[model samples]
Target: MKLSILALASTSVIAISTAAIGQEQDEELRFGLGGAVVTQDEGYKDVGSETQFVPAIAIEYGDFRLLGPYASYTFFKTDSFELAATGMLRLDGYEQADGDIFKGMEDRDMSFDFGLEAEIDTDFGEFGLKYTQDVTNTHEGYEATLSYGLPITVEKGRIVPYIAASYASEDLTNYYYGVKANEATADRTFYQVDSATNFEVGVSSDWFFGQNHMIKADISYTSFDSSIKDSPLVDKSGTFQVLLGYVYVF
Candidate 1:
């Protein structure tokens, strides 16, 4: 079966974008749905993960936000853990049989995906959980994140600094870092699947330079464990991302 893991990977990115939008306490309720083009470096520098188109939905009631109930024809959900283990074993056997031991000795090939997130307000700020599922037949895995926001006062506007940590379950870490045969490239038919764990720490600032307008900058470090540490699939070992958007709170 051809695994649609790409769909799941893409979903993870979408979940982030969904949480990026600002929220308000006075509003009774609100809903939104959107998508973005994301560039991921799973582990390869020259060969980054595929550019994906991901979409999501969100509902907000006062201080709480739920990321989905929204659906996409492009993606689907499935069991990630079971699939990931099976994929690892398959890649390991494929490598031993082909006897082509070098770069392609592991199964690091993965896919894009779609999923959901739910959050609420607290004295500390906002807290939430996110889950994403793979859509392929080869390997499967998902990513889950927990975060909190802290608000500080500034002369010009409100500066909100947020901290979040995410875990890409064993299934996910192994799939993207796993090994398998290179039937697609006509190289060797053997490969190994590497188990991986990705952790990220970052801060974000929302500056109200003017009404309904804000400036945002986010910087984070994402690292992986296992042989994938040396794999070429990673695009950025350490990176920074900045974004600008308009936020209107009623």
Candidate 2:
């Protein structure tokens, strides 16, 4: 399985997803460092709310940006529209070492995904569209996502409330949640997952101070579709993840 460079932000990669487009500024390099934590409970039968601390390292140079496991390069832009090439790592699968529920299950490997994304900003809000495919045959699948966010300028910073939906292919869904015939046990049944759509609602905020210091926090809830919920491996219907961090812009 391919390793993800970082897990500093939301596994959904929305830290860099607000506009899905980089800010329009003079060609310059920007960097920040901090630490973040995430807490999640995503339907895994035996898994409780899993939390972890990750170092946050973000870099933006000219038309390129890198944050955690997500990276993008903006090649086209306009006053209210922009397009970019993006990539991220798939960290959805689990290993046997993770828990007994996966004791005899074949390991579902992670993969790198690459795609093109477009963003549109209007008085009402921002809209982002993306289509990605797993380059590695690990899952041999593709997915598409559509998201909307409303940015409310606040004191010295901004807050964004957003909603997003992603459609995953059968291959992708099955790879992460399916139970194979040979892998099934007395308690686990052989199950196959079809294409599924998941929905998410989130709010993210940022506070700026002392010229270069910034603090950020984000919270989100994701609802899985029936296709995934029916999996014996899953026990919950939804999941929540939270992220908070501080950094000095330089």
Candidate 3:
């Protein structure tokens, strides 16, 4: 199954872009180095929370932005609205050490996704919508998301709290979470997962120091749908993730 990491990373990209668009002036080119610590389920049965430290990199030039495995290009922009094409490298699947339930299951390889997105800046916050398809044929399915972000300024920094809802096609969920008959064991019976909808609420904050240094942090909670929670491969009905890091822009 696609973890919360990718989703949060994508959201961060949008948040940063939203802030940049409001600025009358910005660096022609900027780069940052940081990292994140994520707490997530292993997406399989009998697995506990897994914590991982991942490199965090951000690059931006004009209307283009890149953050880790996610990238986007703002093709059209105005004071209240913006349109962009987005892509992401989905890091999913599991290793043997994850759990015994996955001992005989085939690995779900990472895949590339391409899609279009639009964002609207309103008096209340920024609203976003996106639709993406798996370009690698790994799942032969699509996913869509709707979200809103409200930014609150504190001192020299800003805090953005957002809420999002997502939908995953049956093909996508099954491909990643289902248990095939041939691979099922005595403890894990064959199972199938249908299209599912999930919801997320998160808050991200960034504190600036000078013109080149900043610290960022984010926390989020996700509630899975019955379609995914019912799967024998999944042990948890929800997940919570946290990210904290620093960046240097040049």
Candidate 4:
């Protein structure tokens, strides 16, 4: 069906959880339920903010790690460095029912990505790198990201602020943002998207109380380059996302 905004919210949860990789997790299992409120533009003409409930999962079984919809398997690890095979759902693109701009446009489908990830946890901060391609072929594109996060301890929890840069392949950008000649109309002219990079900054926090009660939240903003900003399907240059959720640790 339509994975639209809900998928984006879930991705935000994934980002927050992934950024907290240096923190300790429950070895056996950590699962709970929570809801998040997300606001994003994606540069679409009329679409705005949205929300839904999502799972809170932090399970480390052997070399595998699960964070909400994001999953990874570590094949190699050292005291401070690890390399893993990663896979996650790419919940992007649009449905015709989403906005009027998509009336004459074909529905872009959601796809899955598979790739490799490397991470390093040091005294200063945690650094992460990932490279993924669309295995489902919905976009036939690839992406790479580099991120850094530093954790700070508060009274009963940890606050982490991270910055990341992502490079989007032309195939991926065009599939989601560009309008083709066959799908173009008088109101929407043909446009082709080129490869570009996006920058993001965000902060996440996890507060624990009574051993089982946990509160999680994150706020992030992404700035799009001309490759996406110049698209006929997009109207803005950036988008902001906010998530607030609670999970009970078992």
Candidate 5:
């Protein structure tokens, strides 16, 4: 479920730009339907690499946008800078059946996060910074991200490569990776973890074909933080994800 959530978030980035490219014109709207395949390490014991197919949709209207479980509205903007409010649904953690060590552990439900974002475009690339908090009380924590994106033009399309680093508050990391006293067993002892940071690097490519038709693809790798890696439920320290889809602009 964590990976699925991340997969959806990744697509949001590629789709959000659809409307902004021509914001100076009349209000624009675009809808896209596609599929994505995500491969990620299970953040639990006894669980191995998992892959799943998911439906993908992108929507944009004026300053409002919806990309999967993420939504945002641009309230201030300029030719080279913009500020927006954002929200997203976070799905992470695991169920008891997910692993032997989690046989009697409680499930971590989905969370709703709200945040603010600032972005700037320069000759070097686009840079962004964002901060979010879990309003749903699921984690009752905050997260911050810093990212940069650079686009390269090809004969028939464009490719954007991006790199980012994120910080998760202690409550967020502990809620997902820590072992509670009640959840501990003879073999699995209770554990607590602190805040941590992670990094990701990815590339997205879009190729235009027949009128208003295009294909998009992206691939990324993420490294987990030590706080998350040292958990009794974790097996791997990183994850790799890939997405491919098609879109049409009106």
Candidate 6:
């Protein structure tokens, strides 16, 4: 009787320990830095789509992801499934070059986004679909993205790379650029925003210089397609940008 009781206790402990280990590996917190060179298409001659710098930080903990102070979302998890809810807000201003269409006017824009996501786990990797709704007057439209993730190489280093792309429509592009009639100044024309899409490919890496201190680099190209091509908001062709920065994770 004594031997049987001891055996039963040992089995239960082993089962509990195994369950805990499995759960630990199911979720992870992945922190990374991203940089990109973004270019906007023509029609914004006044804004002269110049090369601007973009720096960003992202943190993923369990089912929650946070970007700067503007975007936050909660995620759901299944055996190999995922879902999420997201919200975002941002403000931006641009300077125009001389001889540009909207040269005399200042370029200022603000936008807000709220959305949901669904993802599936595949043998190749993780695939996801996302939908976002613009809430602010600066951008009042809907957009979506189909994303995928796959491991390219196994190497010894601090940097790992990946690629992503998104497709947007007229409503989405205009919301970000097409100012309403009342929104535009007296001298400026109510330029209509045309349909456009953006394609982006980039790589990201993490450098562990020391304990509690690290460096990161993200570089990519974003091409914007919009009807405001010859308008006052942007250049005739498009705009490009390159961003570089550093961070400390505690």
TM-score of each: 0.49, 0.91, 0.89, 0.89, 0.89, 0.61
For every candidate in turn, the CA RMSD to the true structure comes to 10.1, 3.1, 2.7, 2.8, 2.4, 14.9
lDDT of each: 0.43, 0.78, 0.76, 0.77, 0.77, 0.49
Choose 2 or 6, whichever is better by lDDT: 2
Model 2 lDDT on a 0 to 1 scale: 0.78
Candidate 4 lDDT by residue in tens digits, 1-250: 2365566566555444443443445354434445565555566876665555655555555567676667888899999999999998887877789899899789898889999999999999999999999998799999999999998999978899999999999999899989989998988999999998999999978777765566778788899988889887777888777777665544
Q: For model 5, what is the error of residue 227's alpha carbon versus the real structure, in angstroms, after optimal superposition?
A: 1.1
Off by over 4 Å in 1: 1-43, 47-120, 135-139, 183-191, 209-211, 235-239, 245-250
Q: Write the per-residue lDDT of candidate 5 for residues 45-90, one digit (tens) a residue.
A: 6676666666666777788877777888999999999999999877
| Residue-level lDDT tens digits of model 3 in 96-129 | 5557777888877777899999999998998999
Stretches off by above 4 angstroms in model 6 are 1-62, 92-107, 119-123, 153-163, 179-190, 209-211, 226-232
Span of ten consecutive residues with least summed lDDT in model 1? 81-90
What would the per-residue lDDT of candidate 1 be over residues 1-250, giving only the tens digit for each residue?
0122223322333333334444433355654444434343333444324444445444555434454322322122233211111111121112222223334444334344456655565666766565666665445766666766676767754455666666666566545444344422443323354544455555544455443333333344455554455544333563233332233322
Best by TM-score: 2
Clashing residue pairs in all predictions, respectively, total 40, 0, 0, 0, 0, 21
Model 3 alpha-carbon drift over 4 Å, by segment: 1-27
* Candidate 6 structure quality by residue, lDDT tens digits, 26-79: 366655443333333223443343343344455555556555533434456777
Lowest summed lDDT window (length 10), candidate 5: 16-25
